[model samples]
Target: MALNDVEEAHVEDREGNRYFVYEHLAQGSPTVTNPTGKETYRHSLAATTVRPDRKGTPYLYTLNLSCRQDLWDDLQPLFKESIDSYRLVPTTSNYIAPDVRPWQFW
Candidate 1:
């Protein structure tokens, strides 16, 4: 689970919640070799929580964006916007989505 070329930074959401961000590249290998292999790409802007619980466990939470290298600049903003709009919710079974995205309740 090693991440290559790791770089870390900080980011903040509109409501003032701040997070630690990290960017890195990852490569995968198949259990069996094949004539055709998978391609690797750049992944970036992973924002996570810095503070852990009192138990000393790490509280890592992040959103990742993956796209064609050529489209990174074009699509990065949209991915960041979606990540910024994230809102935490209760894990109870009775929760429901707002009318805007009601189908999510299904």
Candidate 2:
């Protein structure tokens, strides 16, 4: 889904790993209605980190969450927990050549 009115900030997880936190409205998403019958856009939150492999090839990892704007506050703890628990698993297989773009997964 496309994101609009984006905002970003640099943050660190509990282990001191840096991540980019993105907050935005999810465009083309169905409207969510609150208890009062007020319709609101879906608010999206994403935390991303980049780490290099043993060969120095960069890999991207991301954790995404979404909820109705009205429930954002209530879900903050859950979101933080998920982000804080994010970790990368080291692997010897599936290594991409340094000359290849990381996004070219096939």
Candidate 3:
């Protein structure tokens, strides 16, 4: 998929429920979070919770992302701002970006 349209979501077992988080990969090969794919994986897990199949309940964390190139240039900063913007209600975390080589992934 294109850079501005690269979205990744993952689910992890934590606590006693399922969590979800996401990340948005931008285009122009701009400096973004390294392992953003995995980064999103963890992020998605942190967002929500998952119920356990056994006697113990499990919390889930989801790392979901939005593929938007408009913030590609300033993914880190924008990510932070976006979190703050959304956290206005109760969330306590935001997004962080690192530099990575896209071509190397291939």
Query: Model 1 over residues 1-106: C-alpha lDDT tens digits?
Result: 3534565555665344566565555543332443232544455656565433344544444567665444678987987776666544423555442433545743
Query: Each model's TM-score?
Result: 0.47, 0.57, 0.26
Number of the top candidate by TM-score? 2
Model 3 lDDT, residue 74, Cα: 55
Residue-level lDDT tens digits of model 2 in 1-106: 3346685556766455677777777543443344443344567677888878777877677888887776778986888777667765555687654457756744
lDDT of 1 at 21: 60
Clashes of each: 0, 0, 44
Index of the highest-lDDT prediction: 2
Q: For all the candidates, what are their Cα RMSDs to the real structure?
A: 8.0, 5.8, 15.7
Looking at model 1, residue 4 earns an lDDT score of 49
Backbone clashes in model 2, listed as residue pairs:
none
Give candidate 3 regions above 4 Å deviation. Answer: 1-6, 24-68, 77-106
Candidate ordering by lDDT (highest first): 2, 1, 3
